[model samples]
Target: SSVMVELVGQMKDNLLLDFGEAKKIIKEVVNVFDHKFFINRKYLKQEDDSHFQIQFEGPKGMFELQVPKNTTYLLEGEATVENLSSEIIKLLAPKMPSNVEAVGVYIYEGYNKGSHIISNISR
Candidate 1:
C-alpha cells in the first residue's frame, strides 16, 4: 500500500449546486473501499462559496476533495491510488451533472514527482 494517493473528478461548467451532492458522491466512493475513512468539509466561505474542499483520512491513507469556482472538483492525498482512482470515475460518472463535461483520473506512483495521467473522460 502506498503512503499517499488522490482521486480527483473535474466538472465541465460553472455549476451552482448544493454541497450535499458532492458529499454524497464522496461518501459513496469511500464506502466501496471498506476502510475507515474520515471526511472534513472545508473552504466553505471562501470566494463566495466558489471554493469547497473535503479532507479525508483513515487507516488506508488520507486524501482531499477540492472544488473551486473554475474547476469542478479535485480529490488528492495519500493512499492506495490505483483502485481508488478508477473507482472514482466508475462510480461518479453516472451521477454527475450534464454541465460536468469531463472527468479525469490520475495515479501518482511513489512520491509526487513520479506520476502520469492515467486516463481522460471527454463529455
Candidate 2:
C-alpha cells in the first residue's frame, strides 16, 4: 500500500506564485515527516479551474486508519489518522499567508489506485 496527501489552499492572483508556494510548503512538510515515513514524490495538480493542490506520495504503513467512502476501518500499526491530519494542518498554518488559507488536507491510501481515506479541513 501507498499513502498520499493533498494540500489545498486558497488561490492567489498568480497561478505560478500559488504553485511555487505550495511546492515550498510541501517540501518543508515532507521533510518534517520524512523521519517517520518514506515519501516517494511530490507534485502539483490542478483540481479544477480555480483550485490547485500540492500532493505527495509516501510508502504505506504510515497511516493506521483508512476510510473509504462512508466506511471507517483500522489498520495494523503506525500513525493515527487524526494525529497526522492535525499535524499536517499545524505545520501548514504558520507557513501559509493570511490570504492563502490552508483549506483542506486529504489523505489517501492504496497500492495501485488510491482511495480517499481521511481528511481535515480549516475554513
Best by TM-score: 2
Best by lDDT: 1
lDDT digits (tens) for residues 12-83 of candidate 2: 674423667667786787466544432212233323343333353458523322222222111233345544
What TM-score do all the candidates reach, one by one?
0.38, 0.45
lDDT of 2 at 28: 83
lDDT of 1 at 106: 58
Clashes of each: 5, 0
lDDT of each: 0.48, 0.46
What are the RMSD figures for all models against the true structure? 14.8, 16.0
The local distance difference test score of model 1 is 0.48
TM-score of 1: 0.38
TM-score of 2: 0.45
* Window of ten residues with lowest summed lDDT in model 2: 66-75
